[model samples]
Target: MARKSGSSGEKTRAMVEEAATRLIARHGFAAVSMRQIAREVGVQAGALYLYTPDKQSLLKDIMRGHLQHLLESWAAQAPDPDLPAAARLERFVRFHIDYHILRAEKVFISYMELRNLDCDNFAEIERLRRSYEHILEEILISGAAEGVFHHTDTRLTTLAMIAMMTGVSTWYRDDGRLPPDAITTRYVDMAFRLAGGEPLAEAAE
Candidate 1:
């Protein structure tokens, strides 16, 4: 089926994506079906095709959308490039933890459903994922050049920092010991230490 248009079609498409993300996050990609997603969206199975051609496309779109949104959101509020690397790093750490904790379902599906995407889809998603990772990698590189960060390997540090922050989405709860602000503060401190940069004293306040 052709792609959809108009506000109504766009609204339904968003609904389908949301339902698929929720179901896939809960049950795993291999366990979900188009019919199940349709039911979750309150649409008939046949009508679901009007929004997406197949399950793989839906999975690909969901992951792609999540990563794209991540990049765009960061771009909107990212600290100035001329700022000290530590300051920029602090912003990245806080932004990542705060943004992802609220969308745990999308985060879960993005990581867990990669194997279900087709070759092209996988590559596209990987490209988007790498783009987001590169934002942090560049920060580490700048900090290293400025002698502010002392990591052994920027690439490894970048991956580790992202994994550590993203892991918050897996176990974070509204009723947890720390509120989101405190949790983000702690993660920001950890991120700075992981990158071999001392956390700004104010970061803990």
Candidate 2:
């Protein structure tokens, strides 16, 4: 793992988290051991406890980091705040496909390991995710009001969009025939077509 600039404490914690992410993705959370992760980071197994008091805390750290990125990435690149609802929704589809859905392993880890989080940690992660989804849901509803998007259950549409984006992780492979850009483009096209909100050509997959 690459090193980052931080206090010794922070650096160790970062390495610990990254090691766990790689392990959990290659093997489920249940299959991973603190000793294994410590070995990956070239540290004593007991040393990991200094970073995260328990395995559950380590899991929470992983979930929190992933969810924070998910929310922040969407917030950062979202379309113009004042744009028509459908336009915002269209932008969101493109961003989701290109950014969050593009990386297969990271996406896989985010979805599969989330259930491993403790209840309080899981709820916190869910709150962040819920906020992110609510933004898209509002855009869909607004698009419907503006007579640009097909009227449907916004909740269902939002959930479907998330499911579709998350599903890409399952099938997407680095050595796949298509490059990331091409893959995102194809998925963006598919998403709009399925959403019943025909996309502008540039936005089309």
Candidate 3:
């Protein structure tokens, strides 16, 4: 049967992706199947092909889409280029924590499903992932050039800072002791220290 067109098709496609993400995140990519995704989306197994060629493609798309949206969102909300590097870094730390806090599943899939992707698909996802990392690398480089951040290696520091921030998704809870804002503040302070810079006076308070 031909795939439905127009808004219905769009809706089904979105549902397929959502179901795939949720299932893959919960059960692991190797454990998920197209049939399962179709069931979750309330469609026939064959119907999933309308939106994705195969499970690999679905996984790749999910990872790519997540990274692309992440990059786009950070670009939109990033502080002005003229802002001090510390200020920009603060924005990044807060944004990373806040964004990933509510997106634990997506974050889980993006990190844990990489080994499941085929070589080509994995390369593409890695490229997209690297692009997001480069954003932080640039900030670290700028801070170092300004003599504000004193990291010996910008790339290493960038990776460390990102890993530290992204780890929040693993254990965060709305009912957890600290609120999101408090977590962000502490992470921001940690990020500054990781970069060999002191937190701004206001951020320290």
Identify the leading candidate in terms of lDDT: 1
In model 1, residue pairs whose N, Cα or C atoms come closer than 3 Å (at least 3 residues apart or on different chains), thus clashing, are none
lDDT (Cα) of model 2: 0.76
Off by over 4 Å in 1: 1-6
TM-scores, in order shown? 0.94, 0.87, 0.95
What are the candidates' C-alpha RMSDs? Answer: 2.6, 2.7, 3.2
- Who is ahead in lDDT, 1 or 2? 1
Question: Candidate 3, residues 140-170: lDDT per residue as tens digits?
Answer: 9999999999999888898888899999999
Ranking by lDDT: 1, 3, 2
Against the reference, the lDDT scores of all candidates come to: 0.89, 0.76, 0.88
Residues 54-130, candidate 1, lDDT per residue (tens digit)? 98888888888888888988998999999999999999999999999989998888887787889999999999999
| Model 3 clash tally, residue pairs | 0
lDDT tens digits, residue span 118-163, model 2 = 7888888789779878987888777777777784677888898878
Q: What are the runs in model 2 whose C-alpha is more than 4 Å off?
A: 1-5, 203-205
lDDT for position 58 in model 3: 83
